[model samples]
Target: MFEQAYGRLVCFADGQREIIAMQWKQGATCAVHDHGATASGRVHLVVGALVEERFSFDGQRLCHTTTLHHVAPCTIEVPPGLIHRMTASPDATLTLSIHHYEPCIASMRIYDPEGRRTVIVPDDCGAWIPEDAAAIVAIEPWSAP
Candidate 1:
């Protein structure tokens, strides 16, 4: 259980989208995990720096890893079920980022080093703010009415 804090930035009910800001101190790391079946995500760095790694698994073994280093003002797109992990750089002051989820993340799976899987219900984290009716929309305007 790595230490970190989450703050809800915004959300839309009918549209099924949300933005959550996460704060991480030096040495912090997010557990390797996947977004829910219907969800995709994008993370935008707001402060300091961190690393993101995408992994592929064969049976129970991890393989084909890809990594990205993100500093403030950068963004990365993540597809649903894409096993990934994030870590704050050791020299970082503090890492802050806003995570965007589509079709809203209901549940996700966390993976242990041995490839063991644990279902994590997002609601259980207790890090959400009440949904606002007048928040800025997350979808692209080209698709809007």
Candidate 2:
């Protein structure tokens, strides 16, 4: 039941900061993919200590345990060109606050478990926008296409 809200983080180009209430259901998981330019150099935290997994796919199964980053409110500085994926364990149940420095475009992609993939557009996902974005449009997830 972790919900999103506005935070203290400030976005220079996009304005203020906003939080997204993502309910990583008991068994629900986010697709594996490196962050976009927005999160390229951002540092994030594992506020709720939820269980998850990180993995790599270079024609082989390379998975890693989701390390417990006890820094509840720590920042994560993600470098560019980092390929990774994650999945929520059955115990995950918290809100995710992703602080970005600018507007997200279509550079993000989802690594599908079914072997199908597609580009993830910010307007479509509505996860990278501000708290009060206008004229928004949702892009279809690669799950279908």
Candidate 3:
């Protein structure tokens, strides 16, 4: 079964684990964010292509670590607390992927490098800031690699 959640499709969910489906339009990018500290997951790209930016967060600053370009038919293991952002390849009409999380993500921390701020948001918001935007929890600087 599937339902909508955080602008994506929730393929399945139980208190301990969940699977989500994401669709990306050409040139679309998700916010930089980390899966909850206790959650670990894998992202399986089913179609199209994507560009992924990985980051590291020290207590005081967020820093870009590396970037990767992935084509479809690939899988990425997401370590706990890994911070990253994903963008659909500009040449792709659509990009699709499935994400599986254990202990299902309860909340996530989104980083805004340009604004130098970080916000704690509920899982329903995915890696994006919600329209209400009353969830800011930290203000920190960021640096590029």
Candidate 4:
């Protein structure tokens, strides 16, 4: 959802769940999208702020219906079938989020209202970091299973 987003999959559980730390540069965003029927997740803001916009699909078109503004130290529950997009707060310099996904995040579906096909979510997890963070050392080559 970002032009140059970065992520590090910090944790994995049985190939069915994952914890990803994602960073968004200014003006970065994902297009309107859904997490798939079998997917559910949560986003915890760790730095800066963000603005989320939810949309509704009527088979013919997508309509914007809701907007949520969040700051650091907040949590957002992401239910399956939610069509939404997010961007770093325009006034903010950058944003960071810790994301928890059930059944993995590869199940994400980017919407295409003008066509029949949806974009397959890529497995790119961005750069790897190694450091003692909160008493846990990060692993290398972190990517979606």
| TM-score of every prediction relative to native | 0.72, 0.48, 0.86, 0.73
Relative to the true structure, how large is the alpha-carbon lDDT of every model?
0.62, 0.40, 0.79, 0.66
Runs in model 1 with CA error above 4 Å? 1-15, 124-145
Residues 1-145, model 3: lDDT tens digits: 1112224889899889999998876777888889878999999999989889999987557789999989999999899889999888889877899999997986688876667667777776677767664654443445444
lDDT of 1 by residue, 46-105 (tens): 888888888875545555488888888889888877888787888977777887888777
Best by lDDT: 3
Two-way lDDT contest, 3 vs 4, winner: 3
**Which sequence of candidate numbers ranks them by TM-score, best first?**
3, 4, 1, 2
Error of 2 at 89 (Å): 6.4
Q: How big is the positional error of residue 1 in model 1, measured in Å on the Cα after superposition?
A: 4.2
Which candidate do you rate higher for lDDT, 1 or 4?
A: 4
TM-score of candidate 2 on Cα atoms, chains taken together: 0.48
Give the alpha carbon lDDT tens digit for every residue of 49-127 in model 2. 3333455545434345354432346565445645454333444456344545323323554444443433343433422
The numbered model that scores best in TM-score is 3
- Alpha carbon deviation, residue 35, candidate 1 (Å): 0.8
The deviation in Å at residue 135 for candidate 3 is 6.1
The lDDT of model 1 is: 0.62
Clashing pairs for model 2 are 4-21, 32-85, 42-76, 43-75, 43-76, 43-77, 44-75, 44-76, 124-138, 124-139
Which pairs clash (backbone N, Cα, C closer than 3 Å) in model 4? 1-29, 1-30
Clashes of 4: 2
